[model samples]
Target: MGSDNSTLSSDVITLNHGVQQYFIPSCEKNRKIKIIATPNPSKGLVNINFENWDDIELSLSVFDALGKLILNTKLNTRNTQLNLSDLSSGIYIISIDNHCGGASSFKLILNSN
Candidate 1:
């Protein structure tokens, strides 16, 4: 629930562009959180790194281009590698949410060959 006075904005940028954006709640504007998913053009295996802030639980979710959720799980560690061998080769979106705070998303690719 955002107020009409909230002028905050969220933008999606390409990974190569070197600019990253996250969805910040109006109340947590002063906090810093970073979510990184590596090996973007990966071969079915990828690693997601949650940087800064730890010892807390978080969630990672994967969705297909059709906006359908494929996988969702809670992460107890700061870093975790996801195996998508069961999924077909395609493009998908991975979203990370620090249940206690912020959230962000990034694109991912899976190649079966």
Candidate 2:
């Protein structure tokens, strides 16, 4: 049996057998936006907080389990409240995107009792 030697670079991998694999690394390492949501399993109302978001234009969107758009709006403050009481109990996705190329998402659970 022969030995296998491989090398890896910042964005590529090379095998001793003359094979190369290339890939692009994610650029989100320097993302300046952070978010947190409270009362995950909420009945209808939820509060969200933002961090490191100084004068950054960000947009918030909420989508249901079926990939339907539940809410979409621009965030104008570091803290905001969302009224989901009208929505049914289920798992939803909250996504925030910074027009400057940063984006993040969170999973929210709604419970009806």
Candidate 3:
């Protein structure tokens, strides 16, 4: 048997055979929202920036290396600052969600000293 496939759009794909199958790529929309965290190894203070935000409601979350949630808050601006001076020095995971269909995660290092 032979099969053929075609892309319906940048976000969708279709396959043709005796039976038709549709496949949708994951995270296509999420990729559009660019996230940036400055000073990977920071001294308790960090700056976060977003691109293509389009004024969509977004939330910021921080988790410890052990998978414990350290912080969670709704973002009110395209650029925001995070204060992690209270936390110990180590690696942390920073996550951002647009609350629509886009989400991203980043790694942040905090140096208490």
Candidate 4:
């Protein structure tokens, strides 16, 4: 991703009524941003989150080992949840479509129980 994960400050949050929603910007490559990868060895559930300006839309897609499309989701809300309990044991790629042809990806190693 071109966008630096640094642009995503940990302090920017959105609250409605009494709920607090944290917004993070997508790491765009051309933008020179790096996104952090997590859960190194994730289990049944995995979460892909980003932070940035208040008004940015990002799309996230998941692909499997066979280079097959698995899950495709959009995040205009702030945060989204991805369920990996049903996926097979292997490494998967979560692609975050940021901007200007730049996309950020995270590698997930899942061990099925």
Candidate 5:
């Protein structure tokens, strides 16, 4: 709801019954980053691409639609590929948790065909 930077990057959501949710973008307000996966509806070969944050390790978490933790690892590089051929077809969430109290999430679809 409030942003400490010049741009409006932070978001606050209020739901019924006074429920509040806060969303923060990547680490620093000025630093731009992206997480890309090739062959989106892939049958296992997944390549995640992002800008390398020198010296800063990124924590990655992959969860299924049922909120089950699928993969957890630390990425020290900017580009990486994952072989998820063993996973079943479904919707999954990939979260990048930064050390600067910043977080980014994305949805991934895995199709084994």
Candidate 6:
């Protein structure tokens, strides 16, 4: 898995953001992965959806305003969902990482009743 086979695969191309490197894992080359949040402004509860993937290992987490992980879990398939009704009212960041090679970060704002 450590070998560089990208040069041999016509469909594989390297992608990067500034100084960060992005690549599709060798094990999940044919799969797709995505993450999303609903009700940008969340109140007692929230629904997070991780969509589209043939085979992936995903992680979803909620962080407090200070960037501390208060809730987290691992998901390994499509249409994964997360419930965030136990978190206290405040601004939180939701991070989804396909440990295989994809990741996305977003914010969730929680308000009091």
Top candidate on lDDT is: 2
Cα RMSDs, all models: 9.4, 12.4, 12.7, 10.6, 10.0, 11.7
Tens-place lDDT digits, model 5, residues 55-84: 467888989899999899998887888888
Clashes of each: 0, 0, 0, 19, 1, 0
Candidate ranking (lDDT, best to worst): 2, 1, 5, 3, 4, 6
Considering TM-score, where higher is better, how would the candidates rank from best to worst? Answer: 1, 5, 2, 3, 4, 6
Whole-model Cα lDDT of every candidate shown, in order: 0.69, 0.70, 0.67, 0.59, 0.68, 0.57
RMSD of 1: 9.4
Better of 3 and 5 by TM-score: 5
Q: Give the per-residue Cα lDDT of candidate 2 at 47.
A: 86
How would you encode candidate 4's per-residue C-alpha lDDT over 1-113 as one tens digit per residue? 57433332344333333222333343443333333434546675765444453335667788998879998877665445678889888998777765545555656788877
Candidate 3 backbone collisions, by pair = none
Count of clashing pairs, candidate 6: 0
Q: Distance from true position, residue 90, model 4, in Å?
A: 0.5
Clashing pairs in 5: 1-12
lDDT of 3 by residue, 3-42 (tens): 5564343232122232212221124443465555666688
TM-scores for candidates 1 onward, in order:
0.71, 0.70, 0.70, 0.62, 0.71, 0.61
Better of 3 and 4 by lDDT: 3
Task: Write one digit per residue (lDDT tens) for candidate 1, span 1-113.
Answer: 95454234345432433323343222245655555566767888887665554556777899999999999999888678999978988999888777665677777878877
Model 3 local distance difference test score: 0.67
Candidate 1 least-lDDT 10 residues? 18-27
Off by over 4 Å in 4: 1-34
